[model samples]
Target: MTEVQTLEAPSARRPSASKAPRTTKSTANLGEGFAARVLSVLSEHQRIALRLRHGEGLSPEQVAARMKLPQGVTDRLLADAERTLQAARRAFVEALVENAASRD
Candidate 1:
């Protein structure tokens, strides 16, 4: 009768992309947090609208001329920016809820 001996071998594990850590440069925040991330992903027109109207406090007419956008279009752009920010806020809240749930 022959006796068989079992040998243990080390298991090789590969690191997952999801498990990789993000560097600071790749994950810079323009605003406070996730809310900022959502808000920052705006179209050029939307960003210009925000910069002119809020950042520089420019008049509608001036902003329209400087940005080469119609006055009515600039108004719409401002409204769009507001809408984008509100939507971003909702998304941020949802993300927080999801993250919290995952932790639990």
Candidate 2:
């Protein structure tokens, strides 16, 4: 006598497809005009590189690819942008101190 065997398919439903990827904004409660000042201190390339690196949270390699620039060039652009913003921040702080003192 031959024995009969049966196979059962799984009954559980698969999970739904994930939603589209969402890009995150760089600033969260940044001071008014602060981002503008940071961008203003940088050249066009520097600004774009900085945003891609920090704002979009991309790796240096990714930033370079997106900008169509060599990785070394993108690195230099980010460094330059950082230095410029640092100087601007120092100057802005000094000006704010002076303004506050004059009001007293």
Candidate 3:
């Protein structure tokens, strides 16, 4: 799942990707924590949508067919999943900052 996510998630790309610069150990740790959190919040359907769409690098139409959903619904589902992930990411960063600040 982590490998699949790295395929399309540019911001959360794995350090092994040639296009992305090598990530520091601490940065990678933080990203892992965030990814775990995001996965925990996602529904089973949403996770499947993301894995099919981004992980497989499939088109909306293809994802729809595989998911047995209408193309429009697939598109909307993908969008919603992305929005959820973004929100979770923001919260994760905020929490990290708060933790650091409190420790200081």
Top candidate, metric lDDT: 3
Per-residue CA lDDT of model 3 for 6-99, tens digit only, reads: 3465566455577543457986798897798788787777888889977888888999999998988888888888888878767876886786
* Candidate 2 residue-wise lDDT, 1-104, digit = tens: 11113456688555555643222352223323665766765788987887787778789999999999999999999888777777766776576667557966
Considering summed lDDT, which 10 consecutive residues are worst modelled in model 1? Answer: 1-10
Higher-scoring candidate on lDDT, 1 or 3: 3
TM-score of each: 0.54, 0.62, 0.64
Residue pairs with backbone overlap in model 1: none
lDDT of each: 0.68, 0.69, 0.77
lDDT of 1 by residue, 1-104 (tens): 11113455668565688964443542345225654565567777888777887778788898899999789998898788777777766776576557657966
Backbone collisions counted per model: 0, 0, 0
Q: What's the C-alpha lDDT at position 65 in model 1?
A: 91
Candidate number with the higher lDDT (2 or 3): 3
lDDT of 3 at 101: 72
Off by over 4 Å in 1: 1-40, 101-104
C-alpha lDDT (0 to 100) for residue 55 of candidate 2: 79
Query: What ranges in model 3 sit over 4 Å off?
Result: 1-34
